[model samples]
Target: MTIRDRTAIVGVGTSRFSKAPTDTPMRLAAQAFKSALADGGVGRDEVDGLVINIGWPLGVDYDRFAEALGLRIRFADQSWTHGRFVGPTLQHAAMAVATGLARCVACVCGVSFIQERGLLGGPGDFEGTREEGGTHEENPVYGLTAPAAGAALSAQRYFALYGATSAELGAVPIAFRKHAALNPAAIMRSPLTLEDHQASRFVVEPLHLFDCCLVSDGAAVVLVTSAERARDGARTPVFIAGMQGMRAGPDEFLFATPGLGIGQQREFRYTPTEEQLSVYRMAGVTQKDVDALYTYDAFSPLVWFVLERFGFCGLGEAAAWTQKGRIELHGELPMNTSGGLLSEAHVSGWNSIAEIVRQLRGECGERQVRGARVMQWATAWGDSTIFHS
Candidate 1:
């Protein structure tokens, strides 16, 4: 019944990242799907399971992807369009293979953030309304709205409580921009300096434009199959060593860790205990064993929240922790070595998952985490999966 190391990610593929709507989501997804099949040396007929987190407007649904990609999937699942679903959806793919629901599962996400598609704004906009938003985030009741409000709310609170300034927050994107400069597929590769971050106009008060993720078009796919099948395949396998489900409730904030007091979340001193972050226990390792860390960096504050949520550092210590070269390549704990959602194209965080698989396989050319054996995909909202080479 153990899921650990039973299902391995053997193939990873991604389409070009762009801010322009040069192609459709289905077309982009098809490109990535074929690349993944070829990367794993597996045939299109071998994929029988499909799971997608982003649907419609921002990306394609499971049925559209399966039908358009000519995949005959016996198992399929799709969820609301949000970055929070990335970790859960990937876990579902591994569970499918482990439970024999499908032999090989393709975790797919094709995203186009271009407004020209007419998928965003005007009643078609999916951003939470005052009904759902008032409870979870700060959103306007009129005009076009986005998820940035929630991130901005979280960042403002972190700055006030910990005395961390926006200048300190700039470090997260500054570091990722450095990584993006090395990645050919990244859309925001221009060198970003702290001065540039400070000078950028505010998207929402404390959150400058650079603090938020890019609105880009791209697709990424990761192929999951049993460890036994991977052993017989053409590429090296990156085992899913451990997993912890996404957390929710009155105390959990989508953009902040527990007890940070955003929305309905209660205000208190939050600490990440061993029993709370069981991914490490399930993987039979500790925080010190992780060679690299990757997260859903839709905003700079999320990087700080994820560090505290995962116990990489104490609560409120992330502002100081992320400074220096700590989170950069070859640092104490390299994070988002592929620029993540902040600098890399925002493909609903699937790009970072693809990066994790590449790091474990030693496939990343310049942005690789040297000798990386164990890499983790975690989020500020509290979902995680640990992988090992």
Candidate 2:
């Protein structure tokens, strides 16, 4: 009756990361879904289950998406997952298939974060009611104006605490761009070096332009079904070994409001360490079993936080660990083989999961982690998953 080993991700599809404005969100969703269907050898009519995310400005509800895709799904759910809540929607789709609520399920998302799409706005715009002067009083007084600035504050603390140098911090994006150079689907495949990363302008203090993820326009979809059914698909199935979602309280490090004493300090719970350990226990595996790592790298400092939280390194040791080339493609633990959100595309966390499925199926040609049997995808907020072939 457990969700473990009950269902498999049979197919994955993704549109090329671009800024040329090719299609609407619905059309993008349909394109990715069709590609996934072709990959799985499943027809559109066979899909009776669906899971969709309704991120602000990327609004494609379940019913409308179903209509657009010409699907009549019996089990459909909509979500608005951000940060650590990425994997819940996918897990719901898997559960539906496991319980026989539907046979084949399509999990899809279409995102366009470009200015021309009319989705642009200042920070916290998605939260609504951001009137000019009325909301200013309660706003934190510290420089937590945006995610990048918040990350900068965190990064400054990390550097001061860990004695990490700017060169060490610059290595993360350098490695990501190296990986992106090998991925044709990646948007920023141009060469990037440590020197280049260092020379880039600071979006915020201690965080450079290269350290941030691309603002992308693309769609990605994955098809899930019973393991037995997946055995008959066009490609190998990547089984969902385990998944867990974790969150922090408002008083926690990452959630602390600016202008408050707690927020001004260097204490942020960027990683849910205990919850991550619990997920490992639930999966009955340890970090030693993982063949590759896919972390949500919206900011490069996030990679450092992930490494330490996931037990790859001890507290304040991620910078030194990266300096040793421990996370490169040929290093001890290869990370972000598909370039992640940093270089591949930022469709929330969907692109990262798609890369995980591909690696497990042994579909990645050059950037492949050889003998990649089991892999982990972790988000900055705490959503984590383990997949295997």
Candidate 3:
């Protein structure tokens, strides 16, 4: 009954990431789709299923994409428009392929943040932030607002509780920027220093401008199919070894670890139990087995929280754990080696998924993790999928 290793991500593709809008979502998606088909040695006619994470006008819609790509899709789905839905969208594709509802499923995301700034969370938008409305994270009537405010609140509390500092937080983006330097497609590849991070202006006091992810335009495609059929693919197959769904409730926050006191999250000493972190149990692996890690790094603080949430390190230890090149390539736990959302363009975290596929295939030359047999895609929001080559 277990779905573990039942499906494999056979191919992945992505468009050039840019800070400025060059092509429409459909145009970029078309390019990435063709690339993915070629990479997987798959034909357009073979794709009978489709799943989308971010939809129009922020990205391409499912119905329009099928018609434009000329795909006769038998199964199709689209998650709500948000960065957090990337993991769920991928898991759905794997489930569809494993249960025989479809032979192959193409998981798609083509977003243009540069084009749709006012649609979602941003500075001074028209649809005044409110509880469970206007992006669901904002409640401006009570001075609780989207994104930056929530992250900053958690970071402040974490710092107060654990003695962490913004300078220590610099290590995350700095590590990712180092990785971005090796990637030709990364938007911000320049050398980043702790001093640079410390000096950067604060977007939401206690959270520097560098702490946020880039607002960019791009598309990425990942093809999912059963493991039996994946063995016949052109490139190596990266098996989806395990999965855990997103968590929610009074104790959970979309941007903070459980019990961080953000939004309605309750405050408590949150040291995750083995039962709380089922991804490791489902994957048949431990944190020690992970050669690399990837996450939706929308904010640098989220990186710290994800590490603690996943039991990679004890609560309040990520700030210290991430130091001294521990997360860089060839380090103890290389992460986001393709630069991630901090330095790499944010295609709603799909860019990092494509990076994971490339890493497992040994295709990434300079930034490749050595002996990367196991890697994971997880997020601070608490969804995860473990993949192995």
- Please give each candidate's TM-score: 0.96, 0.89, 0.97
> How displaced is residue 68 in candidate 3, in Å?
0.5
The alpha-carbon lDDT assigned to residue 205 of candidate 3 equals 74
Each prediction's Cα lDDT score? Answer: 0.87, 0.75, 0.89
Q: Which candidate number would show the highest lDDT if scored against the true structure?
A: 3
Summarize candidate 1's per-residue lDDT along 1-389 as a digit string, tens digits: 46889999989889888898879888899899889989999999999999998887778898878777788999998887776799999999999899999999999988888743344334445454535653235455743255677778888898899999999989899999999888888999999999999999998789999998888899999999999999888889999999999988999888898998887889999988776799988888889999999999988999999999999999889999999988988789989989988998889899999999888988889888888999899998788999998
What lDDT does candidate 3 reach at residue 148? Answer: 72
Off by over 4 Å in 3: 122-136, 142-146
Question: What is residue 179's positional error in candidate 3, in angstroms?
Answer: 0.4
Give every collision pair in model 3: none
Best-to-worst order by TM-score is: 3, 1, 2
Q: Which stretch of 10 consecutive residues in model 1 shows the poorest summed lDDT?
A: 115-124
lDDT of 2: 0.75
Which regions of candidate 2 deviate over 4 angstroms? 81-84, 116-144, 251-275
